[model samples]
Target: MDIKKITLFGRKDVKVYSDRPKNIQSILSNHLENLKDKEAIVTEEKTLTYLELDYYSSSIAAYLQKKCDVKKGDRIATIIGNRYHFPLLVFACAKLGAIMVPMNVKLSAEEMEYIINHSKIKVLVSEEKFISKVEDIRRRSTHVIPEEKNVFVIDGKNTFNKLIEPDYPLDSVTVDELDPAYILYTSGTTGRPKGAVITHINVIHSLINYQKIFQTHEDLKTLIAVPMFHVTGLVAQLLHLIYVGGTVYSMERYQNKKYIEYILKYKINFLFNVPTIFIMMSTEEEFKNSHFDFVKKVAFGGSPIYQQTFQMLKESFPNAELHNAYGATETTSPATLMPIKYPKSKVNSVGKPVPVADIKVVKENGEECRVNEIGELFIKGPMVIKEYWNNPEANEKNFTDGYWHSGDIGFMDEDGFVYVRDRKKDMINRGGEKIFSIEVEDVLKSHELITEAAVIGVPDEIYGERVKAFVVGRKLSESSIQKIKEHCQRHLAKYKIPEFFEVVDQLPRNASGKILKNKLKEIGRK
Candidate 1:
C-alpha cells in the first residue's frame, strides 16, 4: 500500500526527501517564494500572508541580531501562547539559528524560572498575561536575570513592534542542518525539566513524516489549538502547515466547547488537540449540534487516548477522520500517526511508525521485544533530538544506541500498530503484581458519570504500595467504585484492580493535559 497516498491527499508519486536543508530559513524562503499570497496563519482576528510572515520573521531576526546580539545557537526564550505571532516568533529564532525556548504556560513561576535559568536564555519574548510571572521570577530567582528589562513582551507596552518596523527585512543568515533550532522543555514530572535540543534537520524530518503519515494538502487549513511550546504544536502543527503552504488558526488555549465553535466557524481542514480535549468536546451537548462539515481530519497527540473516548469522538464527528499520534519533545513531535481512515481493529492503537521515525519495543536490557510484548518504546531517526541542552546526565540516560528511550511502556502488534500501556514511572506495584495506571484509569472512564480518573500507588506498610484511584465527579458512589474494579478485573489482571478509590471533583493535570501522577500520589499519601 502507498503510505503517502493513504495519508496525504495529493500525489502518490511525489518524491520523499530524507536529507534536510542546512537551516530552517531555507524552508521559509522556499515556502514564501512558492506561496507568497497564500494565507499562512490566522488567529482570532488576524490573517498573515506567506509573504508578510516572511518579512516579519526576517525583521524580527534582524532585531535579534542587532539589539540582543543574538547569533547562531543563542538561546531565546518565548513565554507566550497560541496566536498569529507565535509561529513568526519561532521562525525568527530559526532564521538566525537561535534556539527558541518555549515556556509552559501551565507551569508556575518556579517552573518557568527553572527552564529560563537552566536554558540560559538571553532574551525573553513573553505575552502580557505571563509578564507578572516573569517579573516575579526575575526579582527572586538568583539563577535567572535580575533585570526585567531583558524580557520583551509580545504585543505589550514593550513589544517587538518597536524593534522591527513595517516592511523591514534583513539579509537571511545561513545555518547548518545540525544547528539547534529550539530548546523544548518537557515536564520534569520525574525530575527537573530537560530542554530537548531540536535541530533544523530534526524538524524537517518531522514535517516530512507528518505529510506522509497524515497526507496533508497544500490548501489544508489546520486548526492549531495546541500550544506552540509543545513538539506537536511546533513541528506537527505550525511548521508543517508553513512547509506545505497550508493555513493555521491559533487559539490561546483549548476549551472543548469553544474549540468546536472555532472548528465550525473556520471550517478547518485539520484539527490538532489532545485526547482529553476531544473527550470533553465529544461528550458535550453543544458539540452534537455543531456542523463539522469542513473538518476533514482531527489529529490527537501528547498522551494515550482511551478507546471509548476515541469511539465517542468518531461518533460526534462522523464526517471527519480521527487520527491518533505518538511522540515526545525529543522526537520533534510526531514519530507515529494513525492514518486518516478509521481503524477497523484496536481503535486505541497509536497507528504505525511514521516514515522517517523507526520505533521498537525493547526490554530493560536494550534487546528488542517480540510483537505484543510490553516494553520500553524507543524511537530512532532524523526526527529524534541530537541531545538535551546543557544536560549531560539526561543525554547519557535518555539517548543510547542511536535511539531515544521514550520512558513510555508500550508494545507493537504484528501489523506494526503501537499500543501505549503507560509511563514507566507511573506504574504501580502492589506486592509483586504490577498495575498500569492507564488500565485502571481507562476502566474508570468507561463509567457514564466519571469525567476523568487517575490511578496511583500510595504508601502501604504491608503491600509495599497500594493501588488507589482518584476520580473526577460527585455522582460516583461505592457501587461505582465496585463497578470500576469489576470492569478492570474483566480487562486486567487481578493485581491490577484498585484497592482504594477516592472520588474527587477533578484530577490534577499539567497544562498539556497529562495527569500529574506524582501530584495524585502526594494527595493519596496525605
Candidate 2:
C-alpha cells in the first residue's frame, strides 16, 4: 500500500487507496467469477451462493432496466429489513449505476414519505409488514407516484422471487468509481433526516480502511446483528464483509438468544454492533456459560460503553481483538478505530484517525485546539460523503473544504488518540460553567448499583441549564440516590455532579442503538 495524492471533489492532494477496485460492481465481479458456489449469504430461511447472488441480482436489475426504464443515476429505495434481498438490491443498483436508498423500517408513513419524495425515488422495494405505510404514502402525497410494476413487494405475492427467476437478463452498464451508490438517511431524532449521498469511491476507501485496521480475510464470517439501514450494519457488516469475500449471515431482527445461537451455529468470527446491544447480550443466560473463543473480532460504536459490558467482552473473547469504531453515515462507517496494539490506560479513547482520514478539533473561534483541548471534531477524506442529497443549506452548514463537521465535542490527545466527550448540543451549561454529561455519567455507571446511565441538560431559571442523569438500576431507593451523588462528588467536580438523578428501566434508543438525547430532554422537561 502506497500513500499518494490525488484530486477529489475539487480538493487537490487528497490521500486515497493506491490500488483498489474501481467500483463496487467490479469488486463483486471479481468474486462472482472466482468464488462461484461459495456461500455469500446465509439467512434463517435459506442460503445464497455467490453465483446465485449474481444471477438473482442480475435478474432483478434486468427487470428494472427493461420494464421500469431504470438506468444509470436512478434512485431505487428499499424499505425492508435485513434479508438476502437487501444485498441483492445493493448489487443490482451498483451494476446499473443507480442509487439504493435504505429507509428505517420503524419510521412512520409520513417519515418514510418524506425520504421517498425527497430522494425522488423511481422504484420502492418493501415488505408486506410495511406495504400499508407505503400505500399510505401514496394516498397522502402527490410528490411521487410509483407505478404498480415499479413497486416490488417482497412478502405478499412473492414479487421478489418472480423478479429473480433468471428470465430477465441484463448487460453490463458502465459505472464510474465516483458515481453515487447509495443514499442513506440520518436518524432525525431532533429534526428532519437528511439523505447522505455515498459514492463508490467513498465506500471502497472505507472498506480498505477496515481492512487496514482489522486485517480482514476472505474466510472471515460475520452476522448482521443490527439494522441493515444504519451505517454499522450496512457499511461495516454487509459491505465490508462482501468486499473481503466473506460470508454474511442475515439476522432479520436482533435477539440476544439468537445472536448467541448464531455465534455457535455459524462459527461466526467477526462481530460489529452498537454498545447497547453488547450490554444486553452480556446478561443473556447463554452469554456466561458459552465462552466460545471462536469470535476473532468484536467492534462497537454509536455510544460509549459501560464498565461491565467492556469487562464481559474481554473475558468472553480472550482471543479476539476489540475495537471502538467511531463514525457517522457521512463518513461511510469508521473515521476512527481503536488500534489493536494500544495502551490499556487509554481505553476510553476512540483511537487515531483512519489512514486516509484527517481529523481536527476547532473551537468556536475557528482556531485549532491544542492537545487535550475540547472542541468540535471535523473529518475529511475520500470516505466522507460529498454532500447531502438535495439539501443545499445543510450541505453548506455541515461541510467545509471537503471536511464534514462531526458536531461532536472531543479532543485529540498528545498521543494522537481521539476522545469524544459529548455532543455539542448535549453539553450542559450551569451558570456559564461547561459540564460534559459523560463526566457525570461515567462516574454514575461506575457505581455497583447502576447498570446504565444517560445525562442531559434540564432547563432552569437560575442557571440556563442544570445537570440531570437517568440511570438504570435495580430498586433504587431514596438513600441510593444520595449515595450516588456522594459517589459522583468524590470523582467529579462540584459543577459536574448531576443535580438530579432519575432511575429508569432503560434509556430511549433509536433503531441503531444510539441514545436519544432529545427524548431524554423531553423527559427532563416533564
| Candidate 1 worst ten-residue window by lDDT | 2-11
Candidate 1: pairs in clash: 7-214, 7-215, 8-215
242-348 in candidate 1: lDDT tens per residue?
87778888888777778777777778778788787776676677787776666777788777777677777777667777888888888888877898664488687
TM-score of 1: 0.91
Per-residue lDDT of 144 in model 2: 72
TM-score of each: 0.91, 0.98
On the 0 to 100 scale, the lDDT of residue 266 in model 2 is: 83
Candidate with best TM-score: 2
Model 1 Cα RMSD, 1 decimal: 4.7
Give a tens-digit lDDT track for model 2, residues 45-156.
Answer: 7798888888788898998898889989999999888988888888899989999999999999989888888899999889988998988888888557588888888887
lDDT value, residue 261 of candidate 2: 89
Clashes of 1: 3
Candidate 1 residue 154 Cα shift, in angstroms, is 2.9
